[model samples]
Target chain A: MTVPTGQCCAPIAREPLAEDTAAELAVMLKAVADPVRLRLLSMIGSHAGGEACVCDLTDAFDLTAPTISHHLKVLRTAGLIDGERRGTWVYYRIIPEAVNKLGALFAPLTEPSPGPVPQPVAGRSELGLLPA
Target chain B: MTVPTGQCCAPIAREPLAEDTAAELAVMLKAVADPVRLRLLSMIGSHAGGEACVCDLTDAFDLTAPTISHHLKVLRTAGLIDGERRGTWVYYRIIPEAVNKLGALFAPLTEPSPGPVPQPVAGRSELGLLPA
Candidate 1:
């Protein structure tokens, strides 16, 4: 049996899902199934240099810093995002492999179009993008 | 103001999300954020004729009818799918617009590739597909 590993996930509609894979994906989906976390993930994934400082994320919402931290914590725990503390501020970036699993699930259903039309991102020198 | 509607959604990482949009998407995500529901959604979407009969679905799982019914109800309520009654059976098919919204959220982060590699689907003549 070929165990497909690190390939995000097989599309949701592709075949009968293995019980283990479904549970794993459910946990990840639960992580972003909130208004705050969804917005936070969007903000980070779309941010300049493909990463954002936690200090900046807190400023966007009316919630307390601790509240925002809690949401980020959930996302991090689910493996959707990863954080790094650099000096005074911590930075976060999307784990492409994690997010890609979600895409493979539902994207195949849509008719083909441009991959994803990217919004203009200002390349910032401050948040040094970590090497791949 | 050109409010984008019926266009699925602007990609999550493309820009900061509007609050209302994020909330709506969260509700839908919450529906499939379950282990059973995710598997259920996959089974239906990948099924022949792009839909599945409720009676046929229950046979695949170990749970009782009511348990499966409850999960189906959640998926239906969230607008991820639509159902129609035909004689003794109720058939369900994905609501493309809703599922597409999820794709828009996460698909963009992955590198451009073939839209979705479709799995081999055996066309069943029995599941009379309802007209679009």
Candidate 2:
């Protein structure tokens, strides 16, 4: 229930994330943590029109349609994907904002850092800024 | 026990991830899905020398030392972190390769995509390349 209300916290490599921020990200991360859900997201994101119908998605998995539907529901609850019923078939698409937020959360880890290790500043408050 | 053996796969937004690739990423993502573990990773990643001693990390949470240790063990098992015993304290550091891999996995989602939605080329095999 403690979902991130704003932009994702600064990347983990940049500074220690606040407890609440970590909790928010953990929820979304947990949503994509399962194999089936991760694949479902991928397929939806890469499909034509940046979306996939329920019929198309079920073929890629060994799971039953009901099981795939359940996984899609989980992704929807986590805000990773959005589903819309268009006539006879329901379609799903990746929520780019949600996916981008997760990418930003991990961005610092991918970039190289320059120079020596930072000195430990003691007793820093919650708002303390990491040295640049 | 499935894992990405070499580099991580192309981003999900770029193309549909192969089944084996999704399985590998899911395992690593599951490892970081917990709030406590995510916080632990952030702390180690941002700490001095890009590492943190167990003593320093324990004070940051209300959880007991053993619980913290267990979480650290999970991170280590997932290849997100490495710990070394230095005399009285155990120090943990983020594994940049692992962290970077996760970031790269999600990069396409963050960047803007050009033009219209991609066409679904029918009967494409596993090696089909995404349009550039």
Candidate 3:
């Protein structure tokens, strides 16, 4: 049987979510739900090269390399990160499309155009909650 | 002392995220991060009313009413959802501004205006990986 690897996640925006999509998103969110993962993402983003080696990560955090490796794997499986090995260390960086998709998903829901009459801000504000 | 409620979270888009913002987004993401909460957002959005009641939510899921209440509470605390007690049951809906802010943060970084006319997608693509 094929193990469910990265197939579960997709970009959050640009498509209507099926039930499977929700579950997939939940899984990705679960991967980043931990405090360690958040810190990892932050540190990686702030790194000069836009990526960081596991060796550097190990020195910054109190956790062991294996634990850091585990968190990085979680970020990788979630599509939030991509890692490459260089000699003695592995480096990881954020995946842009993944981040973009996630951003789009949480973006206010948009609706197809209705009547052609342009509405005012008040109407838009009221209608905004309606996902149009 | 005041409760550490909504102040903790801010939008993910724009600006260099201070350490506080990470924790805030983490909390907000933590809210919708749950499978049940995801379903709740779906059902609420698909609802004709653009809102949902605890009664409706309880009937939709297999979990007990109290469990549903707890989940809703979690969502509210995370600022991913807002609720109002109307009559006997409370109604909840998604907060667009909060969501918009979250979306913006995850959005690809944009560097200040610099250099000459825009380059092709290839340069943008390579630079895209680098937050320019």
Candidate 4:
């Protein structure tokens, strides 16, 4: 798998997002804009192997299996996670690029190494250093 | 202003999110789940001096001023932004702690300074460096 650099590391706050890009990203964001899906994505992304069996996930919630599947399906459809069938179980794991895109879109930028520190927001000039 | 640390820097992927936390974050996510709101946020965040006037934001969209105001209200209500009225227009700016929480929810962990690099996900062990 090819790793996308630069494009997936820049924060969305660095500039105004274009219309098409915002629309595309909105779909991705909408997919995680739910409590169940957010927890599923978090669980799958942080599981011991960086992946989780559907069986492991079902035990964590009071909701029915179909409901969990539905949420997982939404996450898969959003490109945030992928599932693979392995014999008796389907294992789910995060799609790093997709997750990275979410990170890139909002991650506070790392401190700039070469240039002067970013200017504080107009009215917030009282802050001596803008947290990157 | 009091600064919130630790709580906002830990990524959601660090562990399974608690249900209440998931529900709370989902509300925040819903606010930016739209194409227009995302763009509005980006524009305000990256704008000169880190804030934008309602007039500036209104001109960027083809929708009526009230529509733009509605979207801004969602972001503000979600605690992602704060606005102030100075005579003619209400100037809006990102709430850094809020934005940082969004960033923290997904930002790839920064390079580890003391501990060993995180183990590559179970199947993706082929990757030598997990890019932060």
Which candidate number has the best lDDT? Answer: 2
Q: List the residue pairs that clash in candidate 2.
A: none
Stretches of model 1 off by over 4 angstroms after superposition: A1-6, A110-132, B1-5, B109-132
Model 1 clashing-pair count: 0
DockQ by candidate, in order: 0.28, 0.33, 0.19, 0.32
TM-score of chain B of each: 0.74, 0.76, 0.66, 0.75
- The candidate with the higher DockQ, 1 or 2, is 2
Q: Which regions of candidate 3 are displaced past 4 Å?
A: A1-17, A110-132, B1-17, B110-132
Which structure is stronger by lDDT: 1 or 2?
2
Across residues A31-109, which tens digit of lDDT does each residue of candidate 4 receive?
Answer: 9999899989988987888899999999989999999999999888888888999999999998877877887787664
TM-scores of all predicted structures: 0.78, 0.81, 0.68, 0.78
The stretch of ten residues in a row with the least summed lDDT in candidate 3 chain A is A119-128
lDDT of 1 by residue, A1-132 (tens): 112554545567556577778888899999989998998988776665566788777877889999999999999999988998877678788776677667767765444333342222323223334343
lDDT of 2 at A96: 80
lDDT of 3 at A82: 86
Q: Model 3: per-residue lDDT, tens digit, B17-119? A: 4544555667777877877877776666556666878788788668998898898888777666789988887888766566665566555454421232322
- Cα displacement (angstroms), candidate 3, residue A91, comes to 1.1
Candidate 4 lDDT score relative to the true structure: 0.74
Residue-wise lDDT of candidate 2 within B3-73, one digit each (tens)?
Answer: 23344666777677777788888888998999988888887776656767787788778899999999999
> Number of clashes in every candidate structure?
0, 0, 3, 1
